[model samples]
Target: MNPRALRAAGPAILLVAATLTVFAALAYGGAADPLATGDPGPFVRWGLPVAKLVVNLSAAVMVGSLVLALFALRAGEKEFDAALDVASIGAAVFTVSAGTVGFLTFLEAFNPQLSAGPEFGAQLGSFLTSVELGRTWLITTIAAAVVTILAFAIRSWTASLFTAILAIVSVIPMATQGHSGDLASHDATVTALSLHVVGAAAWLGGLVLLVVLRPVLTDRALPAVLARYSSIALVSFVVVTLSGFARTLSSIGAWDQLGTPYGGILAIKVAALVSMGLLGAWYRQRLIGRVATAARAARSFWTLIAVELGFMGIASGAAAALARTSPPFTETPYSTTPAEILTEEPLPPELTLDRWLTSWNVDLLWAFVAGFGIFFYVAAVVRLRRRGDRWPVYRTVFWVLGMLLLVWVTSGPINAYQEYLFSVHMLGHMLLTMAIPLLLVPGAPITLALRAIAKRDDGSRGGREWIMWAVHSPFARVVTHPLVAAAIFVGSLWVFYYTDLFRWSMYDHLGHVWMVTHFLLSGFLFVMSMIGIDPVPYRMPYPGRLVTLIAAAAIHAFFGVSLMMQSGLMMAEWFGAMGRTWGPTPLEDQYIGAGIAWSIGEIPTLITAITVAIQWSRSDERQQKRADRHADRTDDAELHAYNARLARIAERDAAGR
Candidate 1:
């Protein structure tokens, strides 16, 4: 083998050997018991060892192949490209084989009653029959694993093809699983299982790819690659979160079950995920470019990646265990009573306007509609005109509606939930901190407003003056400043959540409304300040933008961790009333909620930071070049003018002589 191949094979070999050793111990240690119990007979007994071997061997091969591919990215490694191709193909094959074998083995283990006899289908008819369901889960998992592996093995076109296929195949199984579907359906268990499998695969697979390939990529390519990968990771993270929430709600049945064993495990899992995400954010924002620049101690980047991978492993293990265990309180003969259960919910046939409509659902609906309208209108206006103009009536209406809708949504939800209030405050936090900001940042309302004012009839004397003044106003510049916006956005989340203000805000509707409004506004200002979706009143330099992102991310990290460490509920009475149970104890539930805040919350925020940083850097570079060219032209003009003056002076002197 070539040097690169040998180096790549070392890690792969070690990983394979380690996995094999582990599996061997697991298989032999318990193989006889399952066979003796008749829960699994000779078929499973025989299949288990073979399946274990295949899974370990294939994993090694896949890792090895990925390592080899990394070699192709190194400078002066043309020969390595050929080797990479071979390894990639080998990896793809082995990954597929492992998935297949594992699936079959899982089937055998979970569905030992399957017989070659005519009554096979009848025997496996019960959808909830633990054995058959386990087998199906294994099959789906292997399928997802195969597709995810293949997605990274091929060229761009082929990779995209495989990715799309993987997404479709993976989502079908997920939807079929209980978590994504009706909780009361027969497939609920399957849905939950499928989601866990797919979510874990997507997250773990992407991390593995990044860790293995990152070291070899060139500097110029690293940022762009990171940007692309970050986008994918963001999408995956969101899916994982959404799916997890759905599964938790479905499995636990009621909020009070959070105090149970299953709930505790789920909370731990959430914390682990959040920690991993924070680490990922750190790597992307702090270490990524440093690694590319070959800064000293760059190996730290690799170490962090490994740490991330380890956390992912823990989470996966926890998930595997959770799947095997029954949910707490659920196994009891009597179900826990829900605090409030809406019956026969009605849908509105026609839209109605009400000034006193303070319902959470109503606010959320209006916010959704208004947010969409504002974004659409603003985008349209920008596309229509190259130069900035005044805010149009349509745009104005949309902005007002969107902002009002947001205010209503944030306030109403907190108010409604405050009655049961434990973490309803956190829900308020989420709306203010995450959802509202996301909607508003992209809308670029301020920029649109300024543009609209500028578009007024030139003949109107007062209109022109107002437009120019607003555009040039000190208030506009200061408020829209990147630093100022980021501070408010990041600071508000941390301060409100950490202090009595968070609790105090929940007591009354208006207080809650004020808090929510502030949060949404702060988030909007912050995101818009950092990212130039619509024109800002004033643009910060690239370095400033980077600093803003970094500082804000740091603050967010602190917020999450602080919340995770809190000993008591921020809003106890409301939470108790809402039937929001963390696990078995208030503290545990708080920890879990904190974990959710700390970990899952960081994923999107970090992604946004990285995106803004890269965009700003690229834009800054382009702008600098333009400035240089302009400066050169000015210099040339001055030189030409001087030469002309000198010539005239000489001609006059000669004429006088």
Candidate 2:
């Protein structure tokens, strides 16, 4: 490393030292101890959290730097290359730390004696291969190792994108293996923790990347990059804040639990986060612009960055300790009821009409999505209007309505009951895949964004560039093909329900997220192919589109018929096992769901067909108007030519006779 690079590493060195000091103090400060049985030695107990801290730090470094590179840094530029190098280092540390955590976790859980023997090898092999927790860590370590090499080797945009994705995936095992997984609200807890971990890493890592790149970036480039980084940090702050609250709520049973040591540490972490947020706001509002104009402001910028790094270190150390600290609510598995045994959570109250609107079981993922969707869409429309650009009012209305419905479907009664009732699940599916898209597709969000978002001259990719890239990419072309979109829209129903995917979605939070995303995208693509005002890869002729829609509807109806005709329960272990005295029995609810799939589901299909027919009519009318205008412009020359040809044919016949 150059002298400049060594100087860049100074803040991070301070960060690590600070983090280790706080983490060690908290880990050994009566906050965490081995469970009574076979208490692992202090080394094992203390080493696990410390190892986890390294894992967190490394993950932040890997994910955050790459994210900034993708979002802010110009591809093939010196700063971008430096960011990748930073990521490579982070990935290496991530691999080592993850491996250490895996081994130490094995030791803690098994309390196995260390010896050089075949039997010991056999036990270690079983622990790594046969055990879930052990296997998770083993997988995480291997993934990190792969990323280490990939981040070091790859410099291309596409390769780096995939590498960044791999980096994110490497952390999933951490999210899944923790105490959060066994909590009462398993889905919420896992989602929250996963988001928190990723968000915090991105925020801290990007800040670190900025500090490291300070020496390489020129005065003009520095402020622009800082502006970009500020945007990322702002978003990360929101996600980390929200996900933290969700995770905390899942762990602590009541407000009174704040008095507990675990909660006290959480409070400290929250305080640190708030301090960092304030620092970020100060830099964004005050320093970022001035840094480009005044050379002296650079020092102030670095000072703020150093303080932010300190705060981030405190939060990281506290978080590592929090992982080991026992929350107020213990994660003791409950089998008091069959429902609890099956769902890993107790059943909610019986379903009612009132409860349909009132009950809320918020999925933080969808909540944030809906919130951001509304905020950005409204902001874009307002921006256009302020510039005297005409954006249809109805489009904004439809978009807002769609987002609101999304929140309601994901957070309100549908989510509350979907896992328990097949009928409700089907209803949610129809809304997500059909009704919501109908509202959202016509909004032409891509068009609005293309108009509202400013174009960038720098080689660095931003929100607008990324959105454009995705829309025009090869994958988008294939998916947005009318046949492919229709197939996914119609075929996915049978494939998801008949296959293990439905069961997976019920059993796993990640699977549920995938299911929602797949259905939403499928519906969006299909709708966009038909009535969308925005640009697309391809769309068929209006008649061909109508045929596609009708065919898809028919296939969709057959799927409903198949479901109705089923003699056995789908995922009997989940829906059938939810012990309840609800309005409908499990089998009966399945039949109701089938009816919903066929009948209520077709409402949006009918609307789509009507939309296609109307558009077809308008298209023909527009074509006719164009033809008339062309004829007017030509002054009847085509007609005169036709008459002359007839005259020549008549003259030739007369001469021959």
Candidate 3:
């Protein structure tokens, strides 16, 4: 097919592909079959999945267009404008589809009578207001509606970027709702599915944007755009693959479960994923350059994109259908323990020395974070070395070590047991806020990224451009200041604990993620302002930094002591009522946790202070060495002039007297 024709037909192709695949899969998996009881009738059984498929596809286009526009196309340019328009349209569709699905789901769940009467309206309102499922989709629809307006109105880089982020966030609620239970891996499944959904959206939508924009793109521009999109697609593929695998593993406990209908749908989705990956690789490696130089190659590439979008549609449709089909194995062991009731997972074994190193409850989200963090840093280092631009080996080592430790803190025994043990929770907190930052600050990731990322000259913002902007932005300057950073790093602990935020973090996954991110960033900023190798807008003098550290440490210790001497356990329902059969009493464990905060946490602070002192010494020595070199070069003229001026001033003073 000609490129022009292909571009115009892209949306239709994906729609048809998705429509066909979803209907087929739903039939094959018995998803559209009438429910044994509480069936909302066949129309809803079929229409709900179709609406969901639309939701997924439209969300993909919404997220993908903004992402590509932000990273690949220049603001105020035609292609950028077109991308945003596409995003707006996609968001509008997404909003409508989400609302439809939300209502249909209410009907599916309650089998309520369809009517516009007051009683029916009241029931629907209750569902939307009170039910988790109803509220989730309602939130999703509202978010998409907002994104639609933002995407249409925004033309600047920062606004577009934020809109894209908001668009991604809109899909996450949907990711959390699909077929899950009280299984231990429930959180992991939700997390993995969220990632998978976002990744696949970016991958699918970016390609669609490319086809949409090809007519508008100059030959010279297309290659660069393709290169940037390829990079995005590559990362998305990895995330989608890993998260999908984790999601699948959580769903199917037995190998033979693959023979089940749900598994069959999964196999179809997997096949589509594999096909898309292989096609992406082939074109990314061979076609992008050739397309820049040869028209024939361009044609072939366009044709391949058409095919790729079809596969993506198939994958997405399969995913939507899969959500409707019940998983093969959800026979989680029934338990009535308080811990299980509260957390939806069994209480872990007692914290022992052996389990500290041996146990792991991998948080898929942070596992990917560590994985990507290490991969990009190492890749950047390798790029520098290959080009003979130097990056310190020790920096690389520190970064790797920090990332590994992050994995341990997030996925190891600390994470596994923290929900049940206050002391273990505090241990993880200390590591996240102090020890991990200590290692990571020395790595100087910002410095490495600035040095490694290629500067784009096409008036577009790429990774390098955005990083520079963020580092130099007003927010960066303020927060990275020593005083401000110290305040946030230390003050937030008290604020978080004293407020409902602490309880929220314990109960909600989103709140937990926020807690982790807040501390990590606050700690990074504080450490960077003190001893980090990364460049910041401002830094306190060595003596001032030392003073700040001392003040911060003293306050930290006092807070810890206050906790240790508390009259009652913190988060009483959570910590005191876990019904554990091992370890110390709840109040005693709280004391241990507080002791850790006061003592063990201070160890890293001591280490940071020592590092600051060393840096100060080295700085003074370097300044002196420079002064000595200047003296040697100029025969001590500066010092002689200073002495003569002082002598003349003294003589004048004597004469006046």
TM-score of 1: 0.41
- Total backbone collisions for each predicted model: 31, 0, 0
Cα lDDT tens digits, model 2, 73-165, are: 988999999999999999999999998998898888888999899987898889889998889888998998898899888898889999999
Candidate 2, RMSD to the unseen true structure: 2.3
lDDT of 1 by residue, 379-461 (tens): 65765465644445653453555566465654454434433433444555665666556655655554555444444231211
TM-score of each: 0.41, 0.95, 0.98
Ranking the candidates on TM-score from highest down gives 3, 2, 1
Q: What is the lDDT of candidate 2?
A: 0.87
Q: Rank all candidate structures by their lDDT, best first, as comma-separated numbers.
A: 3, 2, 1
| Local lDDT at 247 for model 3 | 87
TM-score of 3: 0.98
Candidate 2: the clashing residue pairs are none
Cα lDDT, all candidates = 0.52, 0.87, 0.91
C-alpha displacement of 493 in model 3, angstroms? 0.8
> Stretches of candidate 3 above 4 Å error?
332-335, 646-657
Residue 449 lDDT, candidate 2, scale 0-100: 90
Tens digits of lDDT, candidate 3, 25-140: 99999989987788799889999999999999999999999999998999999899999999999999999999999999998888988788999999998999898889999999
